[model samples]
Structures are given as structure tokens and as C-alpha cells.
Target: MTSPRRFDDRTDAGERLGEALRDRDVDADIVLAIPRGGLPVGRAVADALGVPLDIVVASKIGAPGNPEYAIGAVAADGAVWRNERAFERGGVDEEYFQREREREAEKARQKAERYRSGRSEPDLSGKTVAVVDDGIATGSTVRACLAMLAATDAERIVLAVPVGPPETIAELREAVDDVVCLRTPSSFGGVGRFYDRFDQVSDADAMSYLKTDP
Candidate 1:
């Protein structure tokens, strides 16, 4: 078993986690990171593992009045993570959900274009893929990503993150072949709370990481 992760920055966290994963397994073809914040961490992982890295862009559909409240989230290719509990709690109808999905789907497409335009998505058929992220919060977005990757004919999929809530990590275990999170705190409030310098990753920084030869 690997030791718990503690780092000064995302690059440090990614390098440490990547080394752990590389020491355990050596058959990953592509390390796909969920853009904006995930890119830098992914770059470090890709560099350490000597693997190709790419983006898996997705966006969440927040409720109208409660913008932070997620009803559903969609990937670039329309894979949806419907929160049934949120529907029950928020009292959202199908029409509202559908409309929000459409809006978020468009945003996802635009973001995908910004992240990876002109470049075709990497072919995952019969290849192992490591999905990297800075961290996971409620896990809605990662679930959407797992669903999207499930449509492809990949040999295996690994979901790797720096940290997440214990319940979210448990929920993710059933979604991917392996879950590689170093920290699953019981009192996890948010991803940013764990990092020392967790700043909002800008589009330029994100795109730069994507373009880097990691």
C-alpha cells in the first residue's frame, strides 16, 4: 500500500501519485485529465509515467436559483450523471432538467473545443487509460467522465485523484477498474481545502498544460 499524499502544490501531488501508480503498474497508454484544473496534475503524471496525456472535458448543469446545486452534469459527448436525490431534494421537473442539460452540454462542447480543437480524441480501443484529476468533490463530474469512457472499447480504465471524500471514493470504486486516490478524508469539505496553493486554473494555463509534451 502507498503512503497518504501530502504536497506543497499540485505538481508535487501529481508527481508523488504518479510515481506510486507507476511503481504498481506499467501498462497505461493514455492519461486523460478532466480539464482546467486537472491538466497540470495530468501533465506531471504523464511526464513521470512517460505516457501521453489528453483532456476529457465535461461541465455540470447547476440549478437555476441555486447555481452551485447540481441537478445533472454532461460530458462533451452527452453522457449524463443524473442526481436522482438532487431531483427529489430540489424538486426539479424533467423539462427543467432537460433544458439545463442542453445548456450545460453546449458549454461542455465549447470548453472541449477550447481544450482540444483540431486535434482528434485519442483512440482508446484495447488500450489502458488513466483518468487523472486534481481531486474529486461530489463526484458527479467524474461519474459523468467514467460513463463517457465506458462507451469506448478501452481495455481498462483507472480513476486517479489526489483526494476525495471517503463516500465519493467508495462510489467511484464501482465505476472504474481501479480507484487510485491517496486521501479519502471522512470530514472532506472540498478539494481546495487540502491544497496549500490551490488557485483557479485559468484557460491559458490549462491549454498550456495540454500543449506541453508530457
Candidate 2:
């Protein structure tokens, strides 16, 4: 067996993810990618599956003082996923959680508007959907997005990522109908660590991916 390792870039990871999905005969009516990073991967996957690509927006609700530390995440439609353990550990109270959830949820809505550029969101009712991202760490954002999707009438919700820690992948499995993960390295550091050129994906670049077919 080939040893697990890093990818050349998000595109490479996307291709591998697409191939994995195909190998498993995953079906999807549409592909919804987490913006800014997931678009590249989503593009490849959507193209491979012969489906239209769309964006699913969510924002991390950081802890009270440490903005980079996520205590939870909220999707555009106000659906949320909170880490109860993290909240207790971080000493996050309900008031603060509610405040952050409201703020982040608004941000997610604005982000979705910006990405769509006034286009209506694709109807997901009764359709099989694949949610793609470059990778995951705590998976707070993906969890929030999946929670939101779960409330919808979609027939299936599949979470696809190129790499993540073993534990993170396991936790995510419970939140979706299926998960297609290419690599789950034990020595997982972060998503960028599994890519050779894991740079910040610019909004313009991400938007371009959405505009292009496949």
C-alpha cells in the first residue's frame, strides 16, 4: 500500500477526493463547497460528478477573548454546532454563545450573498448533496454547515474532505450520511500541513472557481 502523505495543492487534493468518491459510486445532485478554500476542491468534485457547484457559508464563533479559538460555528440560516465540552473548558456562557451565534450567523449570510452575487441558492430539497472542503481541523465549521443541511429536506448529505485527523473524521461521520476522506494521518497537524502549496485562497480566486463550469 502507498504510504499516506501530503498533496501538491488543493486542486490535487480535490482530484484525489473526486476519484475516491467515484470509486465509491457516490451520487450527488449538487456540490456545495465551503467558501474560500473548499471552492477549488468542490469545483473538481462537481466536475467529476457532473453536477452544478454552489457555496455553503458558515462562520466560526470564536471563544470570548481568543478570536481564533472556535467555541462553535453558525451557518447562514442560523443553524449552529457548539462544542459543549469546549464551551465548558473555555468558560463560555450562554449569553456569550448566543451573541456570537447571532453575529457569526449574520456574517455567514452576508458571505453567502457575496459569493452568490444575487443568484438564488440551489434548492437542496430531496436532492443528494456533497459538501466539500479542503480539509478539517476541529470541524466546527463543517459541523455547523452539516447541521444546517440536516434540517433541510435533502435526501443525503455527504461530507468530503481531502485530509483530517483520525479523531476529527470519526466525529464528523456521525453528522452526515457519508464521509469521503482521502487521508487521516495520525500525525495530523493542520489542513495546510497536508498540502505542498497551502496558501490562503483569495476571495477572487474562490469566486472564479464558482463561475467556471466544473
TM-score of each: 0.95, 0.96
| Error in Å for residue 211 of model 1 | 1.4
Model 1 lDDT per residue over 129-171, tens place: 9999999998888888889999999999998888988888888
Off by over 4 Å in 1: 1-5
C-alpha root-mean-square deviation, candidate 2? 1.6
Report how far residue 21 has shifted in candidate 1, in Å.
0.7
Candidate 2 stretches with Cα past 4 Å from truth are 1-4
Q: Quantify all predictions' global Cα lDDT against the true fold.
A: 0.85, 0.90
Number of the top-ranking candidate, with TM-score as the measure: 2
Q: Tell me the lDDT of candidate 1.
A: 0.85
**Poorest lDDT segment (10 consecutive residues) of candidate 1:** 1-10
Between which residue pairs do clashes occur in model 1?
A: none
